[model samples]
Target: MSSNKQPVINKFGVISSSYYEKLFKCNGQNLYKSRSGKSKPSYSVTRECILKFNHTENLREKERLKEQLTKNILRCKRRLGLRTLGSGKHVNIPGGWIEATYLAQCKGDIQEEALNVLYDSLDHASFDYCQLPALFFVAESVLYRLCCDAFQKTYLYSVEMKLAKIGYLVFLRLFVFFLHGHLGGFKAHLLRLQQYLNVLSLSEETYYKYPNIFSNVAFILKTSEIIYERVLLSESTFSPNGNTEGYENVYSDMEFQRHLRFNQGGYEVNHLLWHCVAAWSCVQNNSPKLNNVLEHLNFHKTQLQNKCWLDSALALLVLAEAAKLNMVCLKALMDLVRDFILSIMSAQNQEESYKVNDFSWAWNIVYTYVTILAEICLYAATSDLRKTVFIGFCGCKSSQKNISLKDTVSEDEPVLREASVLGLLKYFSSKISENCNQLIWTGYYGLVYNLVRMSWELRGDEEQNGLRNTIWQTLQKTKDHEKDERIRIAVKIAQAELNDPTDPFTSYGTKVPPNVGDETLSKYIGWRIANTLSKLFFPSIDACAVPLKKLSIKQVQRKYPKKKEDPMKKRVLHFTVREHPSKSELSMFPYPDLFTRVDEQLARIVDHHWQEELKIRQKEDAICEAEERKDKELKEKNHFKEIMKKREEKLHKQTKPYELPPRTEVISLESKERNVRKVTDYRFSTKIVQLQTGILKLPPSAIQ
Candidate 1:
């Protein structure tokens, strides 16, 4: 049988090839049949029947049916040893009573047993069968019970479980898909869970009454944390030559395959770490035993540095709630805020990671919130502590940009740099603005406003005037260059605060005000100075002094020409071929006295020009040498082609020919000389020639 063909069942009940293909296309029909044939309906079919019955009737009728179904589910769940109703025990029930009991109990009231059954379905029942309709029935039951009167007491407890179970169900469903290689499904499930949580609001009574449900909330949070951690860890592990050390290195030798296997089958363990903190915070807010909850929160803070990603956001939310409730100590809350800001700064410096694109924007907004909270907290604290906290919070340098004088001088600094500056300004501005408003509301506006009024009155000195001018120029330049609305607003606010006589921080009542004649102008001048100094020292302590020599416009223009037309248009004439001097040419040219004078002058000019040309050529050669050195260093550092020369050398050596011997002649002579003794003449010939009288002497010639 072809592999692609469907399988067929034989008389013996064995699945044949023809039936396999048919079953494959039947949407898990073969598994359903096999399970049913073994004497029980598949969970899927049972769930389907329940769903069909659920939608066929009104709410009261659905509840009646749900009670019956719940009994059957509980029986099946108990048979599988699943925990129900938080009892940590399995309830045994007859199969016949399960469905009928669930429907009867669920009618017009939340059935705790039905909720137990639903929770069990989440835990033990097959998701393919139990997920969708189970969530719908559970949601409907909880929603209805929350509104119903008779079930209020029981409803609260069961509803918490139901909501939590639904959350877990959604999480698990996502987990299953993620494990099954469907990332989109997992994301969709996560989004749905988020939406559900957004709509969910627990009454204070419910929150305190069911604190244990916080565990489920924690589970949801832990799921998101785990997923994010897994992704980070996976990326780190697979990264080429990635440094696996410290906490990250712990997974180096761990067998991911086995871990993946366990996690794959266990989808119920989807705990989102952030959800846990959020739940705990919720409980802490409503719980009467606030001290204990706060203590518990402090303990959880230790885990935050390692799982800082979500914890930071949670901490902010918790602090915001604390502010709203007016439940926490000002000092303690400020400490938390301080620690959070420090952590964020450290993380930004160490990781260069952004939870959002406009980190500066986010930072400023969050800091503004923190400052506002801190201001309120400060007012709640003693005067000494308020000052300390105020200075500490405002004085902390921004991580995005170093506060240095150079940065202030350059208007075109990077966005982060500008953001850092603006962040500081915003912080100070918000503090003063809020304090001013408070003062006004509290009837201390006259005292506070006069203090700021005094600062402006005192700034009539020449040095202060210059400082003011610099500041005004800087602000104008920044206003022109900055594009972000938040930064621009912040800058405008800072500028206004500096100029406003009622600016509480500056205007805090003083002993005396400036002379009336200079008050208005001095205020303007003082603002300019303060603004300049603020920009110069913002985010950093570095101060840059403008160079004195380059300060004047004429000096700058003299140093750098605004136009190069004359120099650029100047042309030089050069001889294309060298002219040779000849005596005939000179005589024919008949040099005149005027020509002689011109020739002498031209000769001097040529000599000077040649010397200058030689000097220029030398400089050009030096520049070329420097450039070559730089290029060589760059290539060596790159390293890719460095081994090519050695490879070529090796190939050449292998292919080289061996050296040959010098040419030689072989001498062969027949038997000779000795034959003369046998009557054969042996001749030894030696010839000497006599030269003519005029010929050169041969060898060492004897006398003729």
Candidate 2:
């Protein structure tokens, strides 16, 4: 062998060189090597050689090896008196005998002898079967087989002991997984047991004969209950650690456990088990002596509710089943649930109130109980009995003012909670026909309104459609048209479909004639007529009517005024009347008529001002032209005066002005004074006319 051929080390860190040499040499030869002379080998050496030879074999060889191994282990146990009580023959035990015995027991029927053999193997103080994973696997398999085989037998102490041992083994496996940080394995083991129990429960023969199976069933239930309680209690505390806070970690751990249990059939099994136990106890004890069972169930329920964790709905359902089994004390149990529901519904303070998600679970529980309560009432014989129980359950006075439809749903309570309460009332009404009239009327009407409004708002989609139809059918039963306006509104909205169109606005097919009498019809019509008349002619009716007719007459007179005798009088009449129309006519004319008159007068004023402005402009033009001509002449005269002055100065410089030339003066066709007066008069007249028209011609832009 080369130096690089490294030896394989065990956990103890030392490899047996001879062991490897024999192994490699056997591999090369495809045959085993003997320790001494090549004679028949010792039993241990033969076993090792067979194992090494069969390591590469297929299924046929593997099964052959398993049978051989089983034969050897059983032979050894038999020789040592491990299969019998007080036998003197003793034989040394082989390694892996525990696992071999477990497998052998699982492969066939576990008879008394096999059980005795297993017991003897396990009883050794130095036995290490529990530490071996393969031993657990083999033991679980054998236990499962044993349970199936014994499930049909009569109650025997030995069978019960076997079951107890199997259960203990299962528990040990779970604990090992937990301690070793193999949570997945732990959950898988739990699930495996859960499935095993379910199969056990399904066997009616097992349950009927072995009433003590409750012990094994209780083990599973109690394990789940304990884990759930820990989870619930943990959620209420704070965790300072990083992975999860204190209570949160507890919750997480429990939740993980719960997932295991639930996935493994914990819910169905535990609930059924509790009821089965209670029922069996009832029959066996010949009395409702379920205090022990009830106490255990209640402990978990109280924890669930107080912590507001775990599915309260599922817990309540289980409790209700148990309560049903022990019906003698059902009222007290029911009262406890009722109080829980009411307290959750009434939690108004922000801190006290359950979170929205929590409330959903709480409501589910309450609603379920409410349903159960209704069933109980309906099954009662007499109306009086039903009524008494219903009133007691509701905790409201019979004579108290019923909640009206007009009263808004409280903000603190969920809509589903309100719906549930109404459902209860409706149920009570159905059960106690004679005494439930008031409740029926009030509850039915309120429900109709709520459902109708909810439908209109499209809150619950398809669900609300169903509710709307239900309310309609319910309304038909009561036929109380006077009290329920929602019914009336629904009818009116559906009236167009009296002929039964394919669709009604209410979407409830077509309207069916309500069973109302002529008296009711007459009263309804009379009320409508009175309402209309009062709205038409109430306070100050005379004042409005008198002004209306007088204004009409004034408008007629103003629109068709009598022809005036004189033209001047006609013009004055027209101007004065147009300037300020009659107030009565203005007020009475429809808004459009008043607007038209104002528009015409504004147009006329604009035209008059336009003409006056044109005349003033012409006169100004004439006067400006005349002034320009005069100013030109004045300029020429000044130029001539300058020439004369320059000539005189030159002449004096020589001798003197010799008889100054005759002075020439420019002339005009019209006098400046006369023209100024004519222009001023023209400007004044234009100014007066413009001023008068400007007073009448407020801008159309302003009106707009």
Candidate 3:
């Protein structure tokens, strides 16, 4: 394994050089670089083209930009070794979108493989928001947008009359997931999908063929679209809907008695369940709509209890947000999570070793549930981020205070911080420390990986709280027993991170302040670790294969600890990262955990220190201001004498000076003072200006 500087624990090994670089050569020049200079990173050109395509308003120019972007994407796909279908008109391929392009896609079986990776990438983004999803979506968006662009440019005729492109199928898959619809900021990703689908819903050609299949897709599509727009509309304002503020019209509600379902089984879209989730997210302490949204949410309380993929995803999202709000929606989530926790406990009770496929049915629901719950626990337990709370509630200071930071617990709570998240950590820890660790490792690798990542991230006195022991035990056991070489390699990387004190990943944009206490420093490191939590969730290649992936870093490789050395003996852990990573993909800072805020206690300490420093500076500045005032008085006396001397010089130069006479510095009293403006400074007032003017007209006797 390479040193911490390189992302050595990569799930998918780095993408290497490819054949597309020569195909997109502009003006017959080398695509790699100018003969005289360095070239742009692979992603740089494609990203620039995407930005241009979106921003350019000119039709011909926009088309040209789209052409260039298409080429860049194709070049990247080939570079990443991803399959591409060139263009449907590429002569070899017949139907559907493939790879990174909208107009043409890689063939079916190959595209299915790519699409799996794409879905995993999408889930990862909604889960942790790492840098890779940004890359993946950039390419994904271009493909979709270009396909939409081709709706006008290319032929829609097909022999079967069923529909030629399968791109809308991709849109259906994403629309079903809500793609961070729980968080409410994933509008950009879904925005293109809705537009394309809306286009198809209206298209005469599309309706003429595949009418039945697409109608089902369109019905759900419009319903989901309205729900997102309603929730997002609340986010757009400082006030609730129908306020006397910006826009008055409330988003019209779409109604469906029962969720629409297909004959293919369990594939259902519940308008009510999803609508409630959206409404609850926008509900605030003083929201005028809060009572109404809650009323609707409770009305659908039965659907919330029912087990479905949509409900499960929405439940997990609410559970996470509940933790942030000190369980604002605890009553609602307790019912959902109670069953979830039991399932996890049940999975553990199994004696025989089972592969993930042993219970393929349950794995789908439980794997995502555990991964996301583990994420909630990790952020809540290790980092000071929980102190920041939700952004929506911040505006209501009185309302914010009503909510507590700690969980509401009984007297006999576990030894950990009564935060339920802490207990969950102990539960995961018990899995490692106890004998049945093998059960979880197979079915829940993401959960195992998240725990180890949490342990490494909680690099302080906090680790002594049972986490340190569990992490060490897991790493040591995996080094010898793990069959998957990737797991073994990953375990070794964890071991290296623990042993190497000089790691670059340790620093998370925080500097150890001068004269900082041990407790404060520990808290500060917890704050710093918040930035790197996303790296632990590395699931293969995140973004599309771009030139940026080919730009590799030279890192110092890691060597295993010696047999003679004490493995437990440790050097101090350091923490921070570049605060402002470059806009380019070459920047090493992971994007997912970038926005974790400072914890309350840490914020208070820094604020206190800042206030004291501000006072001392104020005192020093007072003394300096007095000294400057004395100097100004002395200078003014000398200025009067110099002015008289200048008068003599001006008197002598009046006959010959070529430069224009000095402009009047004084305002004329005869000139009208516009509209009753009052003078705030008496020092600037001229005696020549009479009291009759707006500068506080002086009395007649005072004037005399």
Candidate 4:
């Protein structure tokens, strides 16, 4: 592998000024299909009538208009059974993005087209029952766009803030079904959303003062991206006409990137091995980006660990794989980690306001950090990395000087003596055969190595099992390892990758997977070497994305808590904390019926038509059910009659009793003697076959 060049990121986070896109993706998705998003007939008619009535002062004229309006509304309601407004007549859109953006790539075009039609209708007005999936998609897109627009205009986002909040509930449920787990390509779509989150959490001030939805779906998506960008990366270049699933490939796959978006994207491999996709992208000829992800972490918050626990832990863990970028990066990371841990232990002056319920993050942080250190240890164990590199990476040289054992221990707290040293380090170190009797600690290398070794032992855990297997296959270079499940399902997946490192802007079909619609061979030794060296490791990047829209919701909810159900009914209730919530939770709430008179009339008409159709279907189902029941009854009767006839025949054949009673004389000998005399009359010697029938002689009730 060739040596890596150090990236020099400017204050703008710019590493290179080659052919590329701007910092923020400002190109809007084309949704303008040039078709009129016409208002509902009922809405139009009612609105016109009200306008006309308002203009007239004559009592007789007013009364006549009102009557006429009522008649018109009724007529519209009766006709709704034949046609529903939401069925069509929405998107005759003119712009390109509605049907040809990243959202509509591949087979998703048709689904997207239908969705756009509904979005066009919804963007004009409000109606929930008209269409649900369309609303979900549009609302999510709107929420993302709102954040992006905020980045563009900054303080000018006040107008749509209310609308965005209302749409958040809709956006919260991004997936229609959880069973199929992230079926579409959300890489490009989620970038802007994550970027917005990063801006909100530039500091810890906004996070604690305003508890938001950071712990909600946004963080889940952030983590999922980390795994995806790190694990499922590809070296295959991008293709404009990539989607070949029968739909017109109208999507434009031009990717606009920068350091800001890169940090938000996740992961940054180091100079020791190779940079991750985003970091490497900074060196592109046409367009280059920087690896300035470290700037995203909150150093101030990490310094005060106990004050901002989750944020600090996350910042540290995110840089686990990244510390090996260089000696400078490694040293800075080691110092930060050492200081963060010391802050957790020696916080005697800080107040303990948290309860037991809020203490799981500390354990989770330690476990995760130890596991990452273990991966580094494995790298060091092999000749892949030097122990000196791991030294700074593991913070072995750093020591907690100011806070000694005596500073932590006191006469007032007897337990302080036992808690002087962290037990996790002690037990974990013993496993690696390290001496723990030394007071106040061993050197940084010993402590970090033990943690890493413990991580190696615990690698058998279910979560890391698949990664281990993949690493083994890579090392062994088995033929089966080439057959990844991703390649098999590649045809089904949306190949509209605009920014993945694997799917680059240009390619020579060198590192392409075997037979992925490609007839190329892996004979190029140069290409193999380049691809092999690039896959050595990936950098763990963290942009500290936290959703801030929830702050508005929290402010509102806190000021006016949700109302109780039927306060009048509960005449007497037990005393509670803060009863009778403040009134008017929603000053601008958009109820379906809260539209203008025209829309309300239209809603009524739509409801009436739906009811009429439902009634017709219900009647049809009833008739079908009755006919089926009648047919079943007749068939049962016929079957019963056949059984009865057979029973009557056996009962009337009284010879059965005589035939069975005289078993000795029963035609037991149908031999040659009987054959010889068979010519003569033998009416009483007839063999009975009735015994073989074994039919039940009881009625249905009797059997029961």
Candidate 5:
């Protein structure tokens, strides 16, 4: 090797002379395309090799690697530009992203140069008269990086101008990518871009012309609209007691944000999105026409048959919203929602362990369904109208007071709320009981949310004591074995909420806490932002965040009162009380002779089944014996008939046909004659007797 050349250091600080030769042999674009060697050029490679300049001890090697990385970025950009400007109909999306990654990882002049190359290529290259959507994404990514760089350097003006020139519509397309928490400072750009798009009045044609580009535009618009309404509603009805500092900050932030709010129509992500938008709009206005919208959605609920799970879930979500707004009856919608969820779960119960191609998407659908059911149940459990509706459904002779749909549901006695809460608890329990491998983190999250929220809501109501054990057991199972961090956090939050129902942070993804005193304006704002973001992108771990360690088990225990043993039941107790439930205790309710009861139930069931089997066997045996007896009798009768028939044939063969016919004819003729003679004789005897008597007397002439 020449003296001017130097060996590069690997991430482990080992001198890799071969790797340095390899870097010079091929640039990143070629190396990435052809990776037959052990060291693959991934995003991490660029980060570790060039980004970490201090990895190498040699200054000359460091400078050489930096120059090499810049040249590689330029080469990658050149390749990307060529491909973007190519006349080929189909462009390699992955290849473009690989180059974009290199550019994203590069710094200083190299990053700028790479971004410029992408911009110029995308701006001027419009082969076949239409710009490729792939190329546009590449350019947007580069520009997004540029905006981030500018923001980091406090060049806000340049960042704004760059985004403006790139267009807000383009930023909307790129928004979901940032939602995964990869883009740190660039998320601020989302709100600003939202503001800009909201202010600008884009025509229907402008949005509709490119359906693919503006596919999620309708959702974006509706989301913005709902957030705005919620913000106003929060400000107007702001609570100030719990966490007042957070509340002030949230209120001030929302009040400061004056984004344009309008209901826009274009392509929606799905039919569910459309209905949700319409439902939110009608719900906010308290329009009576929401009934018609609900009817429309119900009419199309049959579409779930042909559609995917997402559509089925979205349809349920719309119905749930309708129920929430009181446009549809809760009782009717609950049955539909419950059945739909069960059906979805049943469909996913394949025996084979198949890897999901789109686990995130599948998980999202399940999560969405679970959350929709949870919200519906929560609303029904809390709302007074729902209580009245439930009373009417149950045929209770309760007064039909006219309560508005928007009325705050007062914490009433358990009778009115028990039905809804019990139903919701049953749903959560059943979902948690499903196969662990099949259940996703989001599903668990929703299930835990419902459990904890219901437990919290039903606290202090003695009627829910039995259900507390069930909820506690489920939380324990989830907490012990949950692999997903998000789900574990949710379970922890639910447990915390169960411990202290007064905690404001217990409400993970919703604004409404079980204890209203703990709720604040900021918490509600957080809920709204988290929820909208979760739906817009996908569910995130932070979306349903609760306070970390602010709650302690000791505190919860302090509030929980010890139960006095029932003297009558204690006589039957054979077990000792422990501080915490054992594994078996958690699996089954820790009650005296619980296992004995379960064993008894199982024994009775087995005995019933065994008796049924015995009866069936006896019936079958009796039927078989009867059939055999009938068959034997039939064979004997046939044998007797055959013998008689043979004898008759022999007799007929021996005698003439006249002799055989005479036997039947003679009997018939003789019997007829004898009967005739008897009738004549009887008449003659009676007449003769009467004549003799008459003759003996004087007047016998008429008889003669």
Candidate 6:
């Protein structure tokens, strides 16, 4: 509520402040304090340390606690999977999967309470800590499971149905957490998880399944460690016992098996998904591995028919990756890409709501498609990017084609001048109009790179200079108004690439010009392409740019009717905290939303904290002002004292008498030493040559 620039810290309204204060206060204390002369449970110790790690005010203390826990886990692993007290007492919390079972058994209120505890603990975890990413992974997995449960029970109209909605909020919060931390270390988890599942095989099921079945917690811990290693030491080593031959064997033989069923729970899908990801990871120019993956992916195209949205999104990403590898002919792949885009766009149109669930994979799909489009523009053969095709193949409406730019070719031409460029821009602009900020922000960088690259590649109307400028200006506005620092930084980097002269867009310092050597430029281009696509799955802040429109501004305004507001009409809907009913008064209502009450209470706490913070700020400002005034007076007094000292010194100097120089005497030199020294000296002789006289005579004649 206050305009002050300081952060507001609300005092706890329902929960006591000491609850959090005690967490921070017990930074280095042993968890098993002798309460009634008996030590506490292992879970208690773990929870206490985790809380301390989460809330400790001192960075050094937080690190010490984190290192202590890490050491404990490492020691437990080293001791033949036995928990022990080596340097200090340690505890092992239940793994995410095991915890899920316990969560399922808990009653509704207990589950909500437990979720809140986990939320608070995970929310406050140090962003830079090595363990935070794995923690987020576990937390998200658990939250997803909870969400599924709530969704399944929603039809029953039980109290638990309301709890399901909280999962989405938790998901949003978790996403915001990553945004704040720049999604630190999560990429490695993604990569490692992909690698682990990629090499897993039904043939070696016993090896992988035994540990997971018997001791799931340890398995989870081991997986977390491997992921952390992969993230922290990416180039140091590779996963041992990868099933390259087995994966190929399964891909080749599994489709024809008589007993093969598509209903293998989520395994078959996950297996395929991981393989696609791994193949994408291992992609190289004209790679045989990529070719094989593409063959397998083509075989499973039918399997993609009934898959869930998340799995479909993964398959699409793999397809985009394969496209980048140039595994197939451009024309055929372009048609496939266009058809897929059209299908997704169609699905989006048919959907009535653009809620979180409906738009879950929207960003990922757009990101992948944009990346593929960029790749086509950059790396496709000259014939591919510039080849003219019937406008029907691109799925653009006739009206869109009719609205032409000033320099565009005639509509009677019957074919697109640059089919790929026109199609990609039209689709991109439509998607931009949908107001999916996450999708736009994620894909904006790659779009910029492609636009600049295409601007260099294409000339005249096909160059799309106006669209490029508009998109860049849109991103500029988003960057200026965006709240999330991570997104702002990413936008700034993208802008630097597009607008900064010294920042060569490609890593190899390849200038954005045509006819550059492809070998060096291609590698740098490949990296930018890959990195641009990778950051899209993560989310970010919304944009403030005008919605992209297919029609010209003048035409659009002409089509729609404008209305003037009546100043006499009164507004109907309004809310104020003062108008809210007290808890006692609300108890008589037949149905009351507890969630709304909690939200209002939290808001009240925030307002109170803001007012308190404003008062503190005002006090601090008054103190500063007094100090400044005192300092000013002191400085003036010093200046005056200095001036007076100088004047006194000047008067003292002016009052002093003049002085005179003393007389001195000079003595004459004696000649006795000159006669004494001549006794030991030898005489010197000199001679002159006769050739000089001849030269002087010749010179006089020459002058005349």
* lDDT (10s digit) by residue, model 5, range 642-690: 8767867887554433445548888999999999999999998988787
lDDT of 5: 0.41
TM-score of each: 0.24, 0.22, 0.30, 0.22, 0.28, 0.28
Give lDDT per model, in order.
0.36, 0.38, 0.37, 0.32, 0.41, 0.38
Error of 6 at 249 (Å): 17
Alpha-carbon runs more than 4 Å astray in model 4: 1-318, 353-360, 380-704
lDDT of 6 by residue, 229-292 (tens): 4344443221111223335555543222211222212012334444454355545433455556
Model 6 misplaced stretches (Cα beyond 4 Å): 1-336, 352-357, 380-421, 430-449, 453-493, 497-499, 502-704
Off by over 4 Å in 1: 1-75, 78-105, 108-110, 120-158, 161-194, 201-210, 218-704
CA-only RMSD, every prediction: 39.2, 46.8, 32.4, 34.0, 30.8, 35.6
Best prediction by TM-score: 3
Instruction: Give the RMSD in angstroms, all C-alphas superposed, for model 4.
Output: 34.0
Please provide, for model 3 over 552-626, each residue's C-alpha lDDT reduced to its tens digit, 9 standing for 90 to 100: 222112244335767889877655457555558375545442112223356577779999999999999999999
* Highest-scoring model, lDDT: 5
Which of the two candidates, 2 or 6, achieves a greater lDDT against the reference?
2
The alpha-carbon deviation from the true structure for residue 270 of candidate 4, after best TM-score superposition, in angstroms, is 20
Please report, as a residue range, the 10-residue window in candidate 4 with the lowest summed lDDT: 516-525
lDDT per residue, candidate 4, 1-704, as tens digits?
A: 11122222222222221101111112221122122433221122322344456567798987786565545433332322112322334322111112211121112223233233322222222222212223333443444444444335533222233223223333322321110123123344344345444554342332221112222223333343443443235322221122223212421111211111113222332211122222222322222223242332222334324422323333443343333333333344445555544444344224363342233234334433443444443432232232333232233333222122322333452221111113223222222223221112222222332332232232334533433333332222211222333222221111221112342112322243322111011111112222222222211122111111123334577999987798567576776546654456434443332223444587688889999999999999999999999999999999977776786697864343334555555566556567768744353243223323544244579669
Over all chains combined, what TM-score does candidate 2 have? 0.22
lDDT of 6 at 189: 35
| Candidate 4 or 3, higher TM-score | 3
Per-residue lDDT of model 2, residues 1-704, tens digit only: 12333334332222233433332211123122232435331233242433333353577766665666557555646543443322342432322333333333322232333444444443331212223333334344444554555554564444344444444334433322231223332233334345555565455444322222333343434444443333222222211111322334323222222222222111211222233234334433455445544554454444435433223433343333333334433544455564554455355234345465244334323433543344333333344433333344344553122232223334443222222334344432332233333323333333333333222332224433443443444444434423444335433332321223333234554433322110100011112222221222221222221111122344578999987586555342445777788877676533444434555678798889989999999999999999999999999999977777888687654323555434342223246667888999999898778878885455779769
